[model samples]
Structures are given as C-alpha cells and as structure tokens.
Target: VDDLCDRAVKASFASAGQGSYGEVSVLLTNDLAMCEFNSQYRGREGPANVLSFPAHLRSAHSRVEVEPLLWGDIAISFDRVKYEAKCEAKPIRDHTAHLVVHGTLHLLGFDHKEMLDIAAMKRLEVSSLARLGISDPYSAGVNVELSAL
Candidate 1:
C-alpha cells in the first residue's frame, strides 16, 4: 500500500508537471467496507470501483481545522479492480494505475460531469498514464464486452 501510494503521488506530480508535495494515503480493503463508505459519502447503492476522499475541504473547514495542504486518501477496492481488469481484458496493474490516476485527478478537481469536461479529463488521464508507462485503458479498439465477463 505504501509503495502504491508513493507511485500514485509521484504519478500525480509527473502529470501536473509541477512542485506538488501532496501525499495520497492508500487503503486496500474489501468491497463491503467500500460499499458502506460509498453509501454514506456518495449516496451510492453498493461498491463500484475506486473511491477518493479529499482531505482538505476549504469551505467547510477553517485554518485551525486541519492540515494546511493535505490532499486526500484514495481508497481502492481491490475486488472491484480485479473484477474490472478481468472484465475489460486489461492487465490488473494497468487497470489499477488508471483508477489511481482517475482518483488523483478527482482530488485535483478534474471532473467529468459534462461532455467537454469528460473529453478533457479523459485526455489528461491518458496522457498521465502514458507518462506512467501505462497505455490508455479505455482506447476504443478493444472488442470486448464488459458484461460477458
């Protein structure tokens, strides 16, 4: 977990191409725990994939509330990741890297709520993964059906 977290932060710094000194604390747990977290925080039904909990909530907390520049904790459900990797016919490492990058971008405020924003976020994710020596996980050339798994 420590090594993966380090890689995730390094990946973020490399993607941003800036002097960002934020840490990504990683937790690898079961689907049940993640499902509870998702229900409480995201109002989701069940476990999905990676979940990012940003540490610094500026609006809700003040200067005396928490750390000055704490980034967040990224909780990854290995079960979900494993399932998705098999379903997508992608290497688990590559799939996990993609999700880590996705969660990092979320912490950095790169959302995909709109069409243009989705494209921009996808581009950034692809470029970042490339820098991390990971190919685009969602390239359109794969002739695999996710449900068939």
Candidate 2:
C-alpha cells in the first residue's frame, strides 16, 4: 500500500506540473471514521471512498514558494475501496491507486464541479494512473454501483 501510494502521489504531482517535491499525508481508515469526515467536511451522509484536505489550495498554474511543500491530507476509506473494487470487478490495488490519484488531484485544486473541470481532472487521473501501470478508471466498462465509491 505504501509503495502504491508513493507512486500514485508522485504521478499525480507530475501530472499536475507540481514537480516531485511535495508531501501528502494519507490516512487509511474504516467506514465509521470516513462517515464522520463525510458528514463534517462535506455535509453529506455515509462514507466517501476518499476526501482531500489541501494544505494550501492552489491550481497547477499557481506559484508555490514553500520549501518542501506540504501538499495536503488524503483520507481514504478502506472499506469503501474494497466494496467499490468488488463492484467494479477491478483489482483492489488499482481502485486504491485511482482514489489516491483522485484525492491528490483534488488537493491540487482540481475539481469536477463543471463538465470541463471533470474532463480535465479525469484526463490527469488517467495519465497519472497510466504512469503507475494502472488503467483509466473512467472507462466505459466500469460499473458504478450506488453504494460504491
């Protein structure tokens, strides 16, 4: 998991043109903790597969001056990852890698609030995952179950 996370973070940073000097803290937890975070931070119920809390929200074009930048925190629900992977018929590692990359992109100020933004984010995610030998998660064959992340 640690190795996968390292690669995913590196790939995500590179894709966002953030170089490879930042730090990202990842928290692997269960559904209960994730549920609490989802409610408190997102004002939503139940657990999300992953959520990002940026140390300083900035787009790829922003100039960052902090030495050894602390990018952000990523909270991942292990239970949700497992469930989603099972539902999608994908390897757990692939699912986890995708989520880590997605959360890292979010930390880099990439959002899906608009259609263009969603496409841009997904492109970055697919390319970053490709660098890590993971496939595009948004492929047509993938199934998104209601309870899955």
Candidate 3:
C-alpha cells in the first residue's frame, strides 16, 4: 500500500505539470464502497477498478489555479487489480501504476473518447510510468496474446 500511494502521488504530481500543488488521495477499499462511490458520483452501478472524483465544482475563474487546489480523489479496487495482474501475468505494482496514471490523466483533462485524445493520453502515461520504472502498462497484462490457447 505504501508503495502504491508513493507511486500514485508521484505520477499525479508529474502529470499535473510544474507547480501543481494538487493533492490526490488514493483509496484501496472493497467493492461495496467502490460501488457506492461509483453510483453516487458517477451515477453508475458496480465496482470499477479505478474512479476519479476531481474537485468538479469550480467557478469560472478557478482554471488559472486548478492545478494547485485540492484536485480530487481516486479510488481503486485492490481485488480487481490483483485479478488483472494475475490474469495478465504482470506484477501488481505495475498494474497499480497504470491505473493511477489513468486516473491522474483524467484529472489532467485527458479522456479515451477520441482516437487522437487516446493516443495522446497513452503517450503521456507511458512516458510518466517510465520515469517511475514501471512497465508499459498500455501493453502489458490483458494485453498479451492469449489466443493461442
């Protein structure tokens, strides 16, 4: 858990750009809590691997310093991470790094709804994880060619 938090904080700060004092809290909780958060904040039902609740409520003039304000919270499901790691044959730490980076990217106004946007977001994640010595999560677990079976 310590390692997870450390890596997540580093990733969040790095992706937030320079002088970004945003503080993000990463929570490792059970599926029940995750489900509640998902429904309450996202209007969805079920436990997701990771969810980011950015300080969404901001005034028009808040953009200049949104980087320094308390950004938001990211919730991750440990069980899901472990299952994914084992299934994909990757270390849990690496998977955690990917998820953290994913959530942080969301904080930075990146999304996967568009191809170009996805490519850009992925590039940033790959580069950021490299700085932390984490493997390329974009092509790891659940990414291997298991069709041979």
Candidate 4:
C-alpha cells in the first residue's frame, strides 16, 4: 500500500502541476467502515470505492509558515475495490492505483459535477494511470457503474 500510495501521490502532483510539499492520507478498510463514512459525510447509504475529504477548509485560516499543504484524506473500501476490479476485468493493483488518482484529484478540487470538468479529470486520470502502466479504466467494454468522484 505504501509503494502504491507513493506512486499515486507522484502521479497526482504531476497531473495537478503542483511541485510543492503536500500530504494526503489513504485509508484502506472494510465495507462497514466505508459505509459509516459515506453515511456520515456524504449522506449516501452505501459503501463507496473511494471518498476524499479535502483539508482546504480546515487550513484556510492557518497562518503557519512551515506547514506542508494538507491535501486531504482518502477512504477506500477493500471489498468494493476488489469486487469492482473483478467485475471490470482489471487488475486489483491497477484499479487501486486508479482510485488513488481519482481521490487525489478531488483533494485538489476537481469535480465531476460538470461535463467539462469531468472530461478534464478523466484526462488526468488516464495520463496518470498510464504513467503507472495501468490501462484506462473508462475505456470501452469496461463497466462504468463506479460513482463519480
């Protein structure tokens, strides 16, 4: 997980055109835990594959001079990720990498609420996954049931 996170973070930074210090926490847990978080924060009732909470709001008023950018936290459900990978015929490692990239983009303020924004985010995800040698998860023939980031 550590190695995967390292690669994902590097890809995220490159995609965002950011070269400064930043940190994001990634939590890999079960469906139950994910469900709790989903309900508590997103007002959704199911376990999501990935959920990101940006720290921008928390740090908006901070005046610290030496603080690294606290990008945010990402929570992922292990069971859901495995199931989705199997259903999509994608390797688990690759799928996990893709989720990290998706979540990181959210932490950086990317959203899929608009078509144009979704397109831009998808391009970044594709390029970042390519850097990790992972195929495009949204390509034709793959299931697209995964929720928007």
- Compare the candidates by TM-score and give the number of the best one: 2
Q: Estimate the overall C-alpha local distance difference test score of candidate 3.
A: 0.67
- Residue-level lDDT of model 3, residues 1-149, one tens digit each, is 76776676676557545344657677887778877877887777777788876665433223453355666777888877788789878888887777777776675556666688667767777877887887677573345210000
**lDDT of each residue in 1-149, candidate 4, tens digit only:** 88997798689768766654778889999999988998988889988889888877432223345535687889888898899888877888988888888888787777887788778888988998888888878885675444524
Tell me how candidate 4 scores on lDDT: 0.78
Q: Which stretches of candidate 2 lie over 4 Å from their true place?
A: 65-68, 143-149
Clash totals in order: 0, 0, 0, 0
Q: Which structure is stronger by lDDT: 2 or 4?
A: 2
Task: Indicate the residue-level lDDT of 6 in model 3.
Answer: 64
Ten residues in a row with the worst lDDT in model 1? 58-67
TM-score of 1: 0.80
Kindly list the per-residue Cα lDDT of model 1 for residues 25-108, writing each as its tens digit: 677777898888888888877885777777754321122333336678777788887887887788888777777777776666
- For each candidate, what is the lDDT? 0.66, 0.82, 0.67, 0.78
On lDDT, the leading prediction is: 2
Error of 4 at 94 (Å): 0.3
TM-score of each: 0.80, 0.91, 0.79, 0.88
lDDT of 2 by residue, 1-149 (tens): 99999999999988888778878998889999999998988888988889898888576546666635687899999999999898888999998898898898888888877688878888998999999988788785674522211
